[model samples]
Target: MRETSATRRGVLAAAGGALLAGCSGLDEFGESSDEEIRSSRLPDLTDDGESQPVVVETMPIEIERTVLAERVQRTTDLLATLPMSFGADDVPNGYVRKQLIEAAEDASEYIQDARTAQSRLTAMRSLQRARSEARFAAAGWGFVEDGTTETARQSEHEAVIEDANALRSDHAYLGEDPVEAVLFHAEVEQHLAFVAENRYPSGSVNTDELLTVAEWGEHTEYARARVDDGRYLYDRFRESLPADAGSIEETLTTAGESLVDELQRRRSDLPAEPTEGDHELVWRLRYRVRDAAESSARYAGDEPGAASTVLRGAEGLADFLAYERIRDRIDDGEQFGVEEAADVHDARDQAVESVRTALDESPRAGLARPVLADAAQQIVAADEELARLRGTVRPARLDDPIRRYVTATARARSVPAACQEVLDTLTQ
Candidate 1:
């Protein structure tokens, strides 16, 4: 798990990224222009004969932010899986978790396939540099090396998917809890699509701006590819999860839906217009920055892996439940009797504490805040609800507490209603 800015966690996810456009030979987004700048007061160059071609570039900044989000999402997906993998069997849980993590690492190798606009531009610049006599000139080492590397690395993707998937399916009955990898997969895909759509313009945008967007595009493309490969592993892991292990699947499903909704809101919440460009040269920059910020909707969860953290935390609680269930099975006659009500309360309290710890640790692992927030909120709510349910079970015989168990389940057995509430405000 990656460390997060806990200091900033209190802040509602930032309203959005900063967007500005200008031409100081740099776009308001802080990207360099594509035009080979020349100092001149040429009458034809300006409406007032006072301005030069100040092409604005924005793709660089956008790409930088987008890539960061993706990297964070990728890491969090794995870290958040821990608590969920727990069940009666710690060894299998650890084994499966390791497999998932390893699979993610394998996916990462190809995530480089997608480059941001900047990387593409860098490639172009390197080519130019190689041809130039400038002391800074040096050809990007790749061209052919990159292709070979891709070829060598590419085959691993499909193989990883196959292996991971098989493992998950094979282990499905282990009584291990789930981490809900599908939601993670879906969100990463959404981010990939978002990044792809923001492809920076080449001829119309600044050189640096073009490079930035291209770099981001490449990166997302890589992520998309890796994720696509990861599907096999993640899916298998989910499938292999013990059917009776825990209720993490349900909890993660709910959290994922909420996070996805928020993602959608952010996607739609893009500024009605790209930042206003001061000049035609900077228009592309404005577009790229908006696109970058928009794409961020995928990776920048108010929480890491946004909804994933909640599921991960719930997995921990669910695993504990599974452990209790196993103990119950072994006890034979040691049922949920009123005499053991105190013990049940203790178990419930333990579950709550475990969940809280999971929430705190989840964010530390880089799960997004919004996701963690939703999860935390849900867990807290669920725990409270369970307590209320336990009260109902009081005086009742152990055999009769089933109804209480069903009723005391989290109010949000599905996606959180607040998910929609939050999404209604977030956007492109």
Candidate 2:
């Protein structure tokens, strides 16, 4: 019933009065009716909607652009000050520290690029992402640093609470549309609520440190970025709404059908029961595939909110597929101690080989520009993790190594699926 014919009826009309009260002058946008959205025809994806006015909404964050840019640069500089490499003695978790440093560097680049960006909207989005990444690095560093004091952590906890409160208001202005945006909106809302309750979301990455200052700050800032990103995407989708509903509907229908079929295939491929050495992991992945199938099936017929269901299904399907690959290779039962380091090393080597093989099997000698670009990024990430694991893997702490191994393995495994999706999109 949720994915009934009403799904697309008012995809853009769900912005009720309560939600619009906080928005400045955006009330008229929320006042649109289903009939109005349906009747106002616009160019489809292929056509350039140059005739339409550019509706670039204000940046979700209230901070001035220059100030935020400076903060991002400062965070990046702080990260740069740390030694290029850290032993176990230098940091609590070298793998996580390395990732944070890389993330900060990336944020700095984005902030600088936004300065020269021609589009105001694009620049705002880049700035929001940069700021979020910088904050994440700053907060996560507290965990990696050994000498962090309780007083400093308490200060960070208070700052994070403030940040979380600000994000709740900022998120209110984002319109509910495009299944992707809606899903992200819900996640942001949930994360914010968790912050208020001083708890972690279910199945969160930060399971151990539910109330830790560093973890709380990192989680909150990550949610902040999601809110900004979701709003940016919703605005983009609004501008790109096709004048011809039939064309858009047909495309979504075809994609949905493909996703459903893939979901079924993946479900069938999954082990009927949990296997040894990966009992929990296998079942977890199986349930994920099942959940994706259920979600896709909800939007079986092209209905109003079917797009949301389908989009949710696609994301779940990707995770399910990636986890399936992970389950096959991980055997914690066999990995008892430091003596099994060879197995971990071998896993890394195998993951690298799989990525190279995926690239080799690419269509047109991998000349497809989009596929090549995506695969190249995944390859680089895998290589970086591989190198980091090699340098930081100590017998004293296998947790970090295992985490990095899985991260690299999952990225390598997902490359082929990503490639296929790109090819399908191009063909369509």
Please tell me which predicted candidate would have the highest TM-score against the true structure.
Answer: 2
- Candidate 1 residue 182 Cα shift, in angstroms, is 9.6
Residue 190's lDDT in candidate 2: 42
lDDT by residue for model 2 over 1-428, one digit each (tens)? 00112222112111100011110111112212322221112112111122111112232223345544554565466456455665566545655555556556666766775675434444555565565556555555555555454356556556666766776555432332323233333335444555566534222354333124444454445445544444444444444444442224344445556666666566566555544434433444334434544444444333223243344343444445555554554433333233233444454444445434544554322222222232233323333333334322334334333344344345435545654563364246
As a TM-score, model 2 comes out at: 0.34
Question: Which window of 10 residues has the lowest lDDT sum in candidate 2?
Answer: 15-24
In model 1, the worst 10-residue window by lDDT is 132-141
Alpha-carbon deviation at 161 in model 1, angstroms: 6.8
lDDT of each: 0.31, 0.42
Per-residue lDDT of model 1, residues 1-428, tens digit only: 11122221222211111111111221122112232211111011112111211111111111234434444454344333334332435323444334333333333322332222123322222222111111000111121113223332334334534543443343221223222232333333443333334333122332332222322333333433443433433444445555564433454445555555554564564446545544332343234334433544444343333334343333322222333343343246433323333333433333333333433333122222223333233323333333234222333323222222221222112112322333232211
Off by over 4 Å in 1: 1-165, 171-245, 279-285, 296-363, 368-428
